[model samples]
Target: MSRYQQQSAAAAHVGGAKASTDGRRLRVGVIGLGIGRMHIEGWRQHPQVEVVAIADPDAERLAAVGDAFAITARHASAEAMLGTEALDVVSICTPNKFHRPLTLAAFAAGCHVLCEKPMALSAAEGREMLAAARQAGKRLMINFSYRFSAQSRALKAQVDAGVFGEFYFGRTVWHRRRGLPGFGGWFGTKALAGGGPLIDLGVHRLDLALWLMGYPKPTWVLGSTFDPIARELAAKSGKCFDVEDLAAALIRFDNGATLALEASWAANIGEAELMETRLLGTRAGLLQHNLDEGYRFDAHIFMEQNGAQFDLHLHPEAGEAPSAMHDFAEAILQERPHPASGEEGLVVMEILDAIYASARSGEPVRIAA
Candidate 1:
């Protein structure tokens, strides 16, 4: 068999590390030790997934995660891992710098890919990833973790049921009091992270809001960003932080809908953190927000009918929503569309790029068709 086809066939055995009863289970490989650990749990939740290999630039981290997961295949770099292991799927969980190259390599290796948020450092890179996935006829999904929240899933159901007639506007915000991650790490560097809080925190909210709005065609974006808090925080730690602490943008879609998005890693908000999304539609308005800055969320639907107003609430049962990882696995098995496909990620990237561009140019940036 061809090497690529052999890899697909042996996916069931995870390169003989473990035997698959069904023999069709997908062999999964994950890169990046940090978020890659989360990806491991995500894939392991499914019955038809076998985590065969993992890779990281740091050998200590590579061995640590591999040991923790009982995975024997470990490599110091993605190139080495891809070359050595026969994998059916690979998760790219590294920093923003490696997203594009790893995704392309995964495609070339005849493996489907699940990439972390923000897709890549730029819209252009996201486009390249999309094209590579398409050219290789491989599935590509982005892990927009927020969409898998029970609150978001329930609100989406309400919208899909026509409870919210026509989405007109939305405001999504995620702010943290002092949550600048890895001050001296790649996240604090503009070159590695692309931007800062907007790309990190705002991307989640933007994706959730845009998904609810049915992926509207954005026409233009006006944005502003600040690095005030990071500056003070970094000086105290004697480190340098070059990215923004806060970012806000107004994006106009061709369907006459507008969305206001704000994100910040270090803000003076009294709360430790806050995350919320409010959507306005012709029939009703919907709200989904976390309580007390915790992960769990509550959702409410507001409707006025026959001169009467009603507020509907949702109490999602535990595990009401399947995780993005689970859904991505199912898509591969069923040969169906992934929940958060690369195309969607690319569109979100375009909006984010416009946001940063607008912030730089101090004017609205038009999104080209």
Candidate 2:
């Protein structure tokens, strides 16, 4: 058997340590210093959590992050850090390729994991990770950060209140006219990132839409990807770029609902960055979109009352919403379900797999049960 497979099988039998319950702070370790910095900040928000160690393959970046966060226990690899520290939680903020292995390793070490989005390169890998977590009796949460925003939470509250009844169609998109990330690095490499903006940026919007719509089961997908602009740019720079820059898809759900998903790292558009999710329902329609091409977003509800169209703008409550990492820490401390579960991440990965498949086959791909 392969090394990871062996680890996976072993993880099913090894029960990891649970969150501390003796009035002690939870020791946390974060891997991959790039996005791991944010994870550290989020964990610090919880009064019962302390980020004790960090890891990264790049020595320079690792050292810089360690110093900035005042985290003295740092390692050049996850294995070294996991071996040295008795952590209650491990955050896997690595590249797409390392998510599965790191998650399984963390599970084997008896630590709950909070993984970054897209879960892994494929849905199959996501399922394995889920199984490993179940076997270890560990909590596995996905860092679907966008879902923690005030705008998103407000919209979700209304959805739960039945303000938007029986959603039939939804459109979610994240577009960047000239915002290719790490153009010559892993983001542009298909093997490393799994896909371009579709996996990176689109994952957030897709999750937001699905979460608001109660996560309907996707039945089919027809997707297309293009990279003409990225190809030309890569040719000029002489870099290793093999992934699509833009992707669009139409998805059908078993509940007779449909979703239109679009994402692009580079495109001919007015906004430098644009993100929006609109859900059409029987009672009312809801919209959550970014403002001024920036991260701040606004939520709105549209409906007809007294035979007249009306738009109601939503105002978020006073305090700031918790980050996904904060929610993870809270859930573990409270012994409750986290905001974004592994199953939800798996669903997103499955849809992504079908999208890529449909893009390749030039035909609609049916999602397997």
Candidate 3:
């Protein structure tokens, strides 16, 4: 079978739904109270999910979130929660440095993991986490939240339906003029974040674009990273900053397609914030971009029929798209495949690893198949 055929079969394996053998709600435990609050809210949406416990190093923040969510079983650390609760699912919402260790701990406890983005500090760690999940026979999913948007879902449907056939070129980017998160925190620390905007903000856009393009294998990447602005800002503010503020890459895929990716936490640009992804295919070209410098987004398709130029804009209905946690809950309860599986997350990690390597070496980095 061809690669696309294999991908289709794998997707089918995960997409087919089955009824639960017994009607029992899945018990969940969340790690970290920052983004973990959102995870709790999403999991609560599903009737079959019960958030039983929570873990956070910050006792005050943990108590506040746990009380706000009405979850009584709160622990000071993930190890404590994993040791105490009989949770069937665990969500890791901590820093990039903690994802692999926390995910491994959850899997060792025989729980499925819903890990936050950038999978791990590197592809090597991501592979270890994936192997552990497989050994434990549990689902491992990454929170690529951008892909869960209504506009993105609609575009994915169209792409799968052959609306844009054989994507050959693409561009995905996210930039901010001066919007670094937690400027003095771990986000600015290379040891914690692995990298700057590329791993943090760019991962979402890159995943959205690559998923739309069917995630073709990347062959090589030529990339560059810069931190002049962030370093200067850190010096002036007397804050610690060691990661790049801007990064760009040219990636070549195995299917003869090419993608250009750019990300920045600080840049001298007209827009305060900008995010976009465009895929040029043989049949049609597609564009998805944020509107009003906010989370809201819209899509458009460019095509020609009978020698006439045609432009069609998508009108995605307004509704809250199912959260990644909600989808994970349904997948577990219905015995279906997890969305944004570990394998896909590993693929993203591999590309990211290459981008960083290329940036450091000042040459193209080749990915090993």
Candidate 4:
């Protein structure tokens, strides 16, 4: 079978069937009160779910979020929460370094996990987490929020409908003029966050492009990362920044398709923030980009019909889109495949690993089969 065919089969294996939720109110625990708040929000909105426990190293944060969510079981550490709370699912929303351990802990406690992205610091850690999930027979999902957008799903619908027949080349980018987040907090620390915007922001756009392209196997990657403006800003602000402020990569897939990816937390750009992905395919091309540097976006499909070139813009009706939290619960309930499964998460991690490695070595990194 072809590479895309193999990918389809793999997706089918994950999406086709699953175990069960057993009809009980699925109890949930969330770690990292930062983005973990989103996890709590999604679960609380779900009918058959309960946000029972919350964990964070910061006591104040734990208490504030716990009180905000009406969750009484608050602990200063994930281990404490896991040991005491009876949870059916856990959202590992901690720093990149903590993902592997927290996920393993959740799996050990017989809890399915919905982990925040970049999956783990490295593909090796991702492999371990994926293995633990499989051994425990529990669902594992990565919280790739960019793909959860309604526009993303709408594009996926068109791709599935063969509008983008044989997706070949693409460009995915997210650039910010002066929006370096967290200053020199965990986000700017390489040891804690893995890499800068590449792992933090680029991963989202890269994953979105790959997911839209049916996740073609990446054969090799060439990448470059920069710390130009961030280092200067850090010096001026008295905050030590060690990670890259900008990163870009050229990724080639096994199917001979290629994608160029760029991400930056700071740049001398026209837009304050620019997020976009343009795909060139056999049948049609696509452009999905944020409007006015805001979170909202508009997508257009380009193709020729009856000898006339035209564009088809998509506008998903005003409504809530499916979320990582909702899908995690449903995956546990055997309703659908884990929308962003551990396998897919690992592939994304591998791609990220290759990109960073390439940047450091100043050479293209070939992905191990």
Candidate 5:
């Protein structure tokens, strides 16, 4: 079989066949009261999901959210909630360090999981979570919401159709100016949030690029990370900071494609915030960028016939707002596979691990086969 055929088979394997159901609703429990509030709201909107319980270390936060959502089943900890609440699924929105443990615990409780992004601190942790889900005969999903964007899906369709034939190089960037998150909060702490922009923000773009490229195996990576902005900002705000403010990496795939990734939180750049990806191919090129207030995407296909150069612009239809929680609910209810599975999240984490390793060692790091 050809490479495209192999990719199609693999995609089918990861995304299992859709199973019909009797339209019964699934009960969901959400952990971590911070971003867990968003998950609760999203799940409530789904017709096939019911918010049964909520858990948080902060009783006040949990009570506030539970009251707002009119939910009486609330617990002070995820362990306590899981033991009592009969839930079909759990949303793990805790800190980075706790993702693996929380997800595994949820799986052990016989609940499918919808985990927040970055999956875990490392690929190994992601693997363990995946294993737990498999052993428990449940589903594991990662909430990489960017891939659910309309433009992203449209771009993937065009690429798979060979509209941008033989794509060679791509650039994915997420830059922000003076937007250090949470100042000196847990977001800036290395122990709580892993690395900086690369893992937090760049992970989205990195996953988008790799997914568009059909999740090819990465060969090697060379990268660099800086903490200048975080140090200066922390000094001014009088808070502890121990993560990089800026990071960049060059990743080469086994298919001979190269990706240039750039991410920053305090870079002196033109845009206040930028999230964009540009793909260059043998036949055409594509660009998707987020501008002021909204987003812009352009596709260009070039051809030379009879010594005349021609370029065609293809415009895509507008997309709807995507909710990872809602998608997870529908997937569980319909017995369909989710777009962002545990294996895909592991690939993103593996690349992240390699990027950090390369930045620290000042040498090219090879991805294990």
Candidate 6:
């Protein structure tokens, strides 16, 4: 198997260390110690959760996490950890390709899953994972972290309240200037990451857009992808780069609303990082700009009934909401529905697939039924 595939396969076996805890804490096991560390930290904030185990193939990293968490019983494999620890939920933080398999394994092991997005490498894999979750009667949630952002929630409230009447057109963008990740790591490998900026950064905005639009079904998509930045930079730096550095798509929804999407890891744009979403409606328009600045959003409403034009600017209130991971834990414990479900993630995957297909064929691709 290829190195990326081997790494992904090996990840399945990374096990967790044991922690002595009261039965009141919800036992949890985390796979993929890299970003999984974030999950561990988030879970620690909740008194109801006990991160009983963590798994990763890298012995040094595993040992570091175990030591930091003050836990023993470190295993070298996720399967081993799942086999040994009777966890209530397992957080899967592996690469995009491993999401489905790990989630299925967790469900089969009788644990709910909080997986990082873009859920799976493809829509088909997402469907399979959803089915597995349904059959196992376990909660399956994608880590579409943006959904938990206060700005995003506020925008949703406005949209749902008819503040943005009959929303029609929207634009979402996640752009970076020369921000390639990990040089030749799995992130740059198409086989491992599925795609480049679209799946990684773009997926967040896509899900955000869909969620704001009430998870509208995309009917068709036209997209273009380019790897000019990565390929040229790799040639000069003597690095292995084989993924698109930029991707853009136009999506048409079943409700007749249209969305323009753009994502890039490397662009000549002056912005160090720019992430924003804008929605237009008959009654009003809403925009969230400069995501790095805590995703502050501004809402605009127009009134022109008597030939006198008036524009209203709204600065909505914000709050210190719970982290997405924390919310997932609450859903598991409270038996409430998670905001980012497996099915919602599937829609994002379907749009991604369509974008890829459209890019390859140089034509618009219709969403598959």
Per-candidate local distance difference test: 0.85, 0.87, 0.87, 0.84, 0.81, 0.80
Q: TM-score of each candidate?
A: 0.92, 0.94, 0.94, 0.93, 0.88, 0.87
Please write out the lDDT profile of model 5 over residues 232-336, one tens digit for every residue: 768888887888999999999998999999999889887877888887888777777774713454444565556787775555556454577777776666656
lDDT string for model 4 (152-176, tens) is 8888889999987999899999998
**Candidate order by TM-score, highest to lowest?**
3, 2, 4, 1, 5, 6
* Candidate 4 whole-model C-alpha lDDT, 0 to 1: 0.84
Model 3 earns a TM-score of 0.94
Q: What does the lDDT come to for candidate 6?
A: 0.80
- Checking candidate 4 for backbone clashes, the offending pairs are none
Say which prediction, candidate 4 or candidate 5, comes out ahead on TM-score: 4
Clashing pairs in 6: 13-77, 13-78, 14-76, 14-77, 14-78, 15-77, 16-54
How far in Å is the alpha carbon of 135 misplaced in model 2? 1.0
Off by over 4 Å in 1: 1-23, 236-238, 316-320
Off by over 4 Å in 5: 1-20, 293-317
lDDT of 4 at 72: 90
Candidate 2 residues 225-292, lDDT tens each? 99999999898998888888999999999999999999999999999889999999999999999888
Candidate 4's C-alpha runs over 4 A off are 1-22, 316-318
What is candidate 6's lDDT per residue for 1-369, written digit by digit as tens? 222221110011112322233435678898988778778887877878888888888999899999999767677988999899888888898888899888999988988888988899999999899888877877788888776766667777778887777778999998989778867788888888999999999998888878877888899999999998788778887866778999999999999999999999999997877888887888777777663423344444565556786776545556555777787766555545667888888899999999999999999999976
Error of 2 at 52 (Å): 0.6
How many clashing residue pairs appear in each of the predictions shown?
0, 1, 0, 0, 0, 7
Which lDDT tens digits does candidate 1 get at residues 62-124? Answer: 888888889998888899999989898899988898899999999889888899998999999
Candidate 3, run of 10 with poorest lDDT: 3-12
Better of 1 and 3 by TM-score: 3
